[model samples]
Target: MVKMGVEEGEVMQHSMLTKSIERAQRKVEENNFGIRKRLLEYDDVMNSQRTVIYSKRKNALFGERLDVDLNNMIFDVAEEIVAEAKEQGNFEDFQIEVIRIFAITPEITAEEFAQGKIEGLTDRLFEQAINAYHHKIDAIGALTVPVLNNVYAERGQIVENVVIPFTDGIRGIQVSANLKKAIETNGKEVFKSFEKGIVLALIDEAWKEHLREMDDLKQSVQNAVYEQKDPIIIYKMEAFNLFKSMLAAMNKDVVSFIFKGEIPGQETTSLQARQVNQAPVKTIETKAELVSPTGVSEEDVNDGPKEPVRNENTVGRNDECPCGSGKKYKN
Candidate 1:
């Protein structure tokens, strides 16, 4: 009877130990699962943003109706400018913005702006913007077609592609087009290339920078936990705002570049070459010497020898002489 009781006690103890370990294992697994789920939630946010940016890039890259895309951008820019001007109650600023963005002066007068009946102003500006863009394309085509033809005549059999340079004041890219096709299409093909190149370039740059910002934002928002805030919520809100701002800026840049870009002419090319060749202005750094109230310059005071400070007991004139030639008094 005693041996049976001992065996039963040992088995019960072993069972309890095994159950404890199992419970701990399950708890650890639950913790790991929660961590993975949270990580996935964070990644989901970036995935959505990635999807949006990639979709835009795809459309710009492969879509047949790029002009329609450009037109929509112009209309949006016009609307934003008008909205801003209305908020500021300044029509002069409106005209300035129009000229800056579209490179064309606005015909809408200040009085018309003041009357607050500018509902059709956005549409009007859109039309003007479209016209200006077409005019720019025509001008560029006129300038380049003769040169293109000359090149084609010389190397029609050997040359299949021509490189065209496009610049947006800040950056330049070379776009290649089928030389024969450019001539056949009367430079329409080149224009399309320009549109696609500009859109893709700006989108790529903006999206890349936005991704960097998001990475930084994700790290920074982790500190929100110290403030008893949900880091994910903060990240979502801030990320949305950043994405919107980036998108707006990218759209504006695309529209501005398209509207303002031009094929470099001989004079313009020479001017650019000259500017590049010119020496950079030498900035002379002059250090200003600070003068003390006593008229000693700070440099002189600092560079000159520092006097040793005396902390010896003061010798009264009547009490006599620390010089060790001491008489008891004033000699």
Candidate 2:
């Protein structure tokens, strides 16, 4: 499903839908350039057919003629098929071409095809080819429908996993998730997330203030459960389960969701429900120093590769007797 966003004031910017339309427009324009290039190739083929037709007309004996004459007329008609068909097809004779490709699949086993059939076959050889094709095609046709039906049956099982039937007993809370970053860019890392479980009717300071109060209550309720000094097993149900029921009753808009199979540990529910978010320890770069207790400038520290020192006293070319060669430096 698609939705649009609107604002009463301030910045008048493009919504998600508007951005999608712009992107689709750019794709259409890009595809049109390629489509025009392909049409030029088709036009060249049609012109060649017309040249052949004119060539055939030059010869007088053309009435329902056999061999070459009949071949030329067939090519001419094939070149002039409808534009709808051109768009619907991958190629000019897509259906015929697809059938011809698959026709080889059942006929002449893969091993025999690898052995390679010779070219320029005789009329008797063509009759043998016709019999071979019919035999293979009949075998495939008999089994294909049942095979296709089983494929659809498997597809139906897949569809059931995603779709759970809605009933009167089931209450739906339509929590809005901004999947724009994920869907628009089609990125795996981009996510649909919330600040907390708290939903805002309209995200404003007033709504945020209410959320803070509710968070305070939620924490207090958890703390009270611990103070009672009861068994942890029974206390958890009262602390978490009943609180969730009250939260669900508070609004018809906050969705209760859990990521797949992530049951809460006996010790901890969800760590994300904590009051404050901490930047991970990995975020700190130990090599680079920050402002320290001492008033020292960071720019004073050098952070670059050291240069290699040149070797000294390795050779004195002019006075060398190491090899006793006449060509002193050349050696």
Best by TM-score: 1
Which residue segments of model 1 deviate by more than 4 Å? 1-13, 117-119, 267-331
The positional error of residue 110 in candidate 1, measured at the CA in angstroms, is: 0.8
Please provide, for model 1 over 1-331, each residue's C-alpha lDDT reduced to its tens digit, 9 standing for 90 to 100. 3665675445455788799999999999999999899889889999998998787778779865677777878888988998899889988899889988888998778877777544687877888888888888887777667767876786567556666777766677656566778788778777788888888989999999998999999999999999999999999999999998998888889888887777666432322112111132432212322456687776776896779998987767688676777686578
Task: State residue 296's C-alpha deviation in candidate 1, in Å.
Answer: 64
Model 2 per-residue lDDT tens digits across residues 90-169: 33343343233222222323243234332211222234434543453344333232322332354433221110111112
RMSD of each: 14.3, 36.4
The C-alpha TM-scores of every prediction are 0.73, 0.15
TM-score of model 2 vs. true structure: 0.15
Please state the error at residue 153 of candidate 2 in Å: 84
